[model samples]
Structure formats: structure tokens, C-alpha cells
Target: MMYISELMTGAPTNERCPLERRMYETLDKLKIPYERVDNDPAASMEECAEVDKVLGTEIRKNVFLCNQKKTTFFLLVMPANKSFDTAAFSKKLGVSHMSFAPPEKMLKHLGTTPGSASVAGLLVDEDDYVQVIVDKEVAESEWFGCNPGINTSHLKFKTQDLLQKFLPKIHHRARIVDL
Candidate 1:
């Protein structure tokens, strides 16, 4: 059985990786209150399910994508349960040929690896090279749940804090899409 502990706000007591540490510092600096849980590495929905129970919110899918050119990169957060139609996403965004980004590029731009990507990665994008996209539905939800720049730790916080405070501080903006 999955081991999901009680929900608690702020960073965990145990030591964390550099990436996760930076994420907590960033959140604290911004004064964006959050609740977090250290679950199994979020590689599968089964693990995500256990996290959802602890967080009291559904964990959204954080997809790392790039255009056909591979020059334009994006991090898209959508409903975890919904299927992502790349074609539909392309059409809605007026972009073309969206495909999953290479893992190396994801690490380079987002400071996160596959299955571990999160909006907090934006803090490391000093170049502001990657665009952030959010599904309208997820953006509208009262609470936002995502990894705090690392897969093992998951966070749930006010959607407003993410949209209004976090994004602006990082000089990143979120383009809300229907898909």
C-alpha cells in the first residue's frame, strides 16, 4: 500500500536536493503559502493518486513541450485525468507541431527532469526562454497542486498565489488554454 502521511504546510524537515531547496526558498521569499507532501517519486498516476489524497486536490499534469523547430519551449499544466491532444493544443495556441521536449532541454530550461517538472522550475529560467501554459480549467481551480521543482515532494497552494505572485516574480506569464 502507498504510504501517504498527513498534509503539512511549508518545506519538509528532512534534507532535500538542491533543486527542492531552492523551490522552498523561492516560495518563502514570495510569501506564497503552500502545503506539501513527500510521496513516492511521481512517475505514475498510482503514486499521484496517493498524493492527491494527502493534498486534498488533484495533481495536474506538467508537460514539457517544444515546437517542431525545438527553439520554442513550453511547460503546460493541465488536468491530470484529461488526455492531451497535441494537435488541439497547437491549434488553440496558434502554434504548430507541438511535441514533447527532449529531456536534456527540459533540464536545461526548466531545471527539472521528466515527471518532475513544475512551475517552480521557472525560477531557474533566468533567460525567460520557456513559455508557461495552463489549461483554463486548472487555472480556475481554487487550489493548484504540483511538484515543488522535484518529483518526490508535491505541493498544493492557492491558485491565485501561483498566477498572481509566483509567475510575475519570475518574469513568466501563463497563457491559459482550453485544452
Candidate 2:
């Protein structure tokens, strides 16, 4: 795990990643204040839970999914403790055969690795290729947390600001579902 301090010699500033730096720059432009914490590269929901502890806020589970043809992509955000039922999700979304999007697809579309997927990544999605769905339980919370384009750094911000302010700028509409 790499700490935010290690990545920054002083205060944070806008920076570009290998692919696109839109995510970092977007937050700066929006002036959304946040705090970052470093943690291990969490591979599963349980591992992410451990990382959440260090951030002092529960990180929502951001799942990258696709349809059978891999044409349509979706970003489902839910509480870390919530379970994902494919059947229920498929029915809710009115899609046939929804599965996890491949790592290559994630990188190509969102410029993020598997364990580092965050709604913040939407800044780079110029095509609007993915639909953002946030669990109702998560949306109702006061604070939301996620990675800042890196697994080692987690960011905390106001849920209202993320949904009401940041999301609108990215042209993202979050569907609050039961799952």
C-alpha cells in the first residue's frame, strides 16, 4: 500500500495518470474538499472493508458490469456489507446476463484497475459508456468514501456533494435500488 503522503511531496495538486487525469482535475475544479488515506490493494469486498477502516468511512462497493455482448457497461455502487445477487440485479436493470466487466475493459473505459474502481473515474468517461447505479442505502448516508484513482489512497467526502454536485457535472444519474 502506498500512502497519500508518499505520492505527494507537499499538499495535493492536480495530476495526470497514465491514461487520463480527468478524475483528479474534476475534484479540484469542483472544489470538493476531501481526505485521503492509503491502504492495501483490496481484491474483494472483505478486503475493501479493511481499507475502509483506515479511511474512517465505509467505502461503497463499486462494481463494473456489462451485458452479454459487452456493449453496455454499468457501474453499481452499494454498501460494502451488501450482497450482490446477479439474478436480482438483472431483473432490476431489465438486462439479460449481466456479469463483471473484464479488467481490460475497465482500464480501457475508466482507466482504472479492478480494485481501484471508483465513481470518481466517471470524469474520464467522455463517451458516457457506463450507467451509474448507487444503492439506496448508500445514497441515504451522510458521508461517502472511495479511492482517488489509486488503491493506496481512499477519499472521504459528503454524500450530498458527490451526488448533488459532482455527479451532475459528469452527467451521471444514479439509480437508487434495493440491492
Q: Top TM-score: which candidate number?
A: 1
Write down the TM-score of every candidate: 0.95, 0.86
Q: RMSD in Å for candidate 2, one decimal?
A: 3.1
Query: How many clashes would you count in candidate 2?
Result: 0
lDDT of 1 by residue, 1-179 (tens): 76666788877778888778888888889998998887767787668978998899988888999999999999999888989888988888888998999999989998888888889788789998999999999999999998888877888889989999989988999998888
lDDT of 2 by residue, 1-179 (tens): 43233222122455435433455566667887766655556666676676666666898889899999999999999898888998799999999999999999998887888888888678768789989998988999988988766665667888988998889988887878877
Clashing pairs in 2: none
Where does candidate 1 stray beyond 4 Å?
none
Q: What global local distance difference test value does model 2 have?
A: 0.77
**Weakest lDDT window of 10 consecutive positions for candidate 1:** 38-47
Q: Which stretches of candidate 2 lie over 4 Å from their true place?
A: 1-21
Cα-based lDDT at residue 108, candidate 2: 80
